[model samples]
Target chain A: MSARFVPVPTPETGTYWEKAAEGELWLPRCDSCGRAVFYPRSFCPHCHGDDLTWFRASGRGVVESFIINHNPAPGYEQDAPYVIALIMLEEGVRLTTNLLGVEQTPDAVRIGLPVEVVFEQRDGIALPQFRVITGDGASG
Target chain B: MNRAAGSSPVIIAGAAESPQLGTVPGQSAMMLAVSSARLALRQTGLAWADVDGLASTLPVVDLASYVGIRPGWLDGTVVGGCSSMLHVRHAVAAIRSGAASVVVVAHGESGRSRVGMPPRAVDPASMAGQFEQPYGMSGTFSRFTLPVLAYLHTYGLSPDDLAEVPVAQSEWAAGNPRAYRDKPLDIHAVLSSRMIAWPFRVLECCPLTDGGGALVLMSARRAADLDLEHRPVTVLGSGESCEGPGASFMEDLTSFAGFREASARAFRESGLTQADIDHLMIYDAYAHVPLYGLEDLGFVGRGEAVPFLRSGATRPGGSLPMNTNGGGLLYTHTGMYGMFAIQEAVRQLRGDAFAAVPGVRTSFVQGIGGMFGAAGSLVLSNT
Candidate 1:
C-alpha cells in the first residue's frame, strides 16, 4: 500500500501531534466555558477566551457516525471500502478518524460502538486513530 | 408589484441560465459566467456598462474586465456552493442601501470538464487536512454524506426513506427538458444503483456538469424606470448563516443549525410562514439535503421529511411544488449550484419555468454550502 497523508503541524497544533507520538491523547480545555476543543486551536471556539489549557484525555470515544467509502482518497486505493467515522469523545468533543481493528462492514461496525484511540506513525508523526473496544474495556 | 412597499423592494429584473448548460467544454468558467450575465443583462434592457455592482465566486476581476464593467460595488463572497445565494442576499442589501443600483450575481463552474478551473487546494497544516482528509474521507461523497447515517439512526429511518428524495424529484426532472437526468426514476432503481457510500447510491448524487446562471437585481423602482419586458421578481426576504468548518463540527448531525437559523431569519424578515409559500427550491446537491431542508426550514417536523417527501407533497400537482426545475440532483449542478436554485425560483414566480407550477405567487429558495458548513435562504414573490 502507498503511504497515507502525513499532517504538517502548525504552531497551535504541534503539541497535539507531539503528544500523540508519546502515546497520549491531549486536548485543549477552555477556562471560561469549561469545554474541551478538538483539532487544537488558540482559543475557545465556544467563548473566544484566549486562556486555554491542554490536558491528556481518557483516549476513549464512541462511533457517532460513519461511512464505508468504496471510493478511497489518494494513497488509499488499496484500502477501499474502509470505515471513515466520527468519534465522539468522553470529553464532549467529536473528531474525524478511521476505525481500526474491525472488518469494514455494516454488521461489524456500528454507531455507538465504544472505541479507544490508537496512533499510526507516518513520517515521524503519530496520527490518532481508533479501534473498537471489546470485553470490559469501555472507558469512563 | 409592490406588496413589500414598506421595506425597500429589491427585485430580480432578469435571470438566465447560460446558453449552454450540462456540458460545454468549449467555454472556460469566465466565458460561461459572461455568457449568462449577457443573457440576463439583455432581459433587463441594460448593457454591461450599466451594471454598477458585480458579485461572483469566480475570478471577479477577470469577470469585470471581460464584461466591461467598472462597478462602484463589488461583492466576492465565496462560501463554497452556496456562494451565489449569499451574493444575492448581499446584492439586495447593497441595492436597498443605495450601495449600487444595478447588481448582477453570476456563477459558472466546470465541475466536470475542469477547464480553466483552479487547482483544488488543501493546506497541509489546516484543520481538515490534518484530521478529516487523512482518514481517507473521499471528497463530497464521503464528507457530506457522513451525517446521513446519524440522521437516519436518530430518526429510526431506513435507506428507503433516503431513496424517496430522488424518486420524487425525478418526476419533476422528466418534465424539464433542460435537466441532465430527464428520465423518470423509481425507488427500486435508486436502491439498486451503484452504492457510492453507505445509505447513498449513485442515483441519489448530483451529476458533475458544467453550467452557469446569473440574476440581475435592482430596486423595483429602478426596473420600472427602464420599463423592461420581464416582470420583476421581488426579494421579500433573505438570510445567511455559517456553522463550523466540516460536517463533524456541526452541533447536531441529525439537523443543521445553520439551515434552521438562516431559514428562521428569512421567514421573520418576510413576515411569512410555511403556509404562505406556494413554491420551494431547496438545493439538493445530494438527496439528503432536501430532507434536511424541509425539516430545518420548518416545512415539516423533525423526522417527518422522509414521509413528507414520500407522500408526493413536493412533486408536480402537489400543494407546495418544489425544485420545479428538477433541482441539482437531476438538473445541472455546476459545483456552486445556488445560482441555479434562485433562477428556478424566479422562473416559477414568472410562470416561465420549463415545468411550470400554476399560480406560484411566492417562492422560497434555500441553499447549503460545503459539508453543511453554511446555509442561505431567500423568500421571493411576484405580488
Candidate 2:
C-alpha cells in the first residue's frame, strides 16, 4: 500500500516528531502559566511565555469527540470508514488523531473511551495515533 | 464602548444579493461581488463614485479596480465565513473616524462551481497541516463538525435534538423564494438523509451554493445627503472575537467562548438586552451552530437552546423570529455566509423580506468563522 500524507515539522515542532520516533510522546509545557501546550509553538498560548519546556507525557487519554468519516482525504481512499477523533490527553491538551484497532461504529467507539498512544510511521515521519485500552492486552 | 455605538451613528443604506444566486456558474467570485455591489449602489440610487471605502474577503484593490472606484479606506480581515460581519464592524469604525464616507462590505464565493477559485493549498509547516489534517480530517464536514458529539454527550441530548435545528429553520425557509431548500422538513427527514458526518446528516449541513451579497454602510448623515430610497438600517452595535487555533483547541467542547465574548460586547455596546430583540439571525453553516449561538449569545440558558428551538420559538409568527431568510442551511451558503445573514437582517428591517416578520424593531445577527474558531455579533434596529 502507498503511504498517507506525512507532516513536515517546523523549528518548534521538530523535537516532537523526533521524540515520537523513539516511541515517546513529548509535549511542551509553559513555565509561567503551569499549563501544557499542543502543536508545539515558540511561545506559550496561555501566558505568552517563551520559557517552554518539553516533557514526556503519560501518553494516555480519553476520546473527547470524534466523527466517522465516510469521505477520505488524499491517499486515504482505502482508509475510509475510519475514525477521526479528538483525544484529550492526561496533560489537559487535545490532539486530533486517528482512532485505530476498533470497529468504526457508534457502538464500538464512543466518547470518554480510554485510549493510549500508538505511533504510525509514514516515510521517516512518526505520527501519534490512539487505540482503545483493553485489560486483556488485546485492542478492540 | 465600540465605535458604532459610542460615536456618531452609521447605518446600512442598502443591502442586496447578486442578480444571480444559488447557481451562477458563469460568474467568477469577483464578478459576483461586483454585481452585488452594483445592485446595492443602485438600490440606494448612488453610483460607484459614491463609494469611497471597501471591505471584503476579495483583495480590496482588485475589487476596487474592477468596480471602478478608488477606495481611500480598505479592510480585508478574513476569519473564514464570518469575515463579512467583521467587515461591517470595521466599516463602522472607518466611517465614525471620518476615514471614509461611504463603505461597502461585500462577499462572494464560487463554492459550488469553483469559478476562478484558487486551488486549495496548505502549508506543510502550519499548525493545522502538521496536526489536524494529518488525520482523516478532510474538510469542513470533518473539522467544523468535530465538537458536535461532545456537545450532545455533555447535555444528554440526542441526535434528534440536533436534527430539530434544520427542522425549525426549514419552516422559515418554506416561505423564502430564494432559499435553496424551502420545503418543510421533519426530524425523521433530517435523520434519514445521507450522512455526511456522524450525527450530522446532509440536511443538517449548509448546502454548497454559488452566490454573493453586499451591504452599503454610511453614517446617517451621509444617507440623508444622498437621499437614499430605503429606510436606513441602523448599526446599533457590533463585536468580534477569536478563539484558539481551531475547533479541537477550543477551551470548552459544548459552549463556544468566542460567541459569548462577541455577543456580550455587542449587547453592552448597544446598551440593549436580550429582551429587546424582536428578531434573530445566527449563521447556521451546520445545524449544531445555531444551538451554540442561541446559548452563547445569552438568549437562552445553558442546555436550553435545543429545547427552545424544539418549542418552535424561532419559527415564523413565533415569539422570536430567527433565520428568516432560511439561513445558510436552507438559504444559499457561498462558503462565506456572513454577508447573507446581514442582508436578511437589513431586509427584515426594511419591511421587504420574503418571509418578513411584522413589526420587527430589533434584530440581532451572530456569525461564526471557521470551526468555532472566531465569532462576530451585530445588533441592528429599524428605529
Fnat for model 2 comes to 0.74
After TM-score superposition, what is the CA distance of residue A7 in candidate 1 from its true location, in Å? 2.2
Candidate 1 Cα misplacement greater than 4 A, ranges: A136-140, B1-7
Query: Clashes in model 1: which pairs?
Result: none
Cα error, candidate 2, residue B199 (Å): 1.1
lDDT of 2 by residue, A41-106 (tens): 898988899799999999999999998887787777887878889999989999998898789887
Alpha carbon deviation, residue B244, candidate 2 (Å): 2.1
Clashes of 1: 0
Q: What is the DockQ of candidate 1?
A: 0.77
Candidate 2 CAPRI level:
medium
Whole-model lDDT values for every prediction: 0.87, 0.87
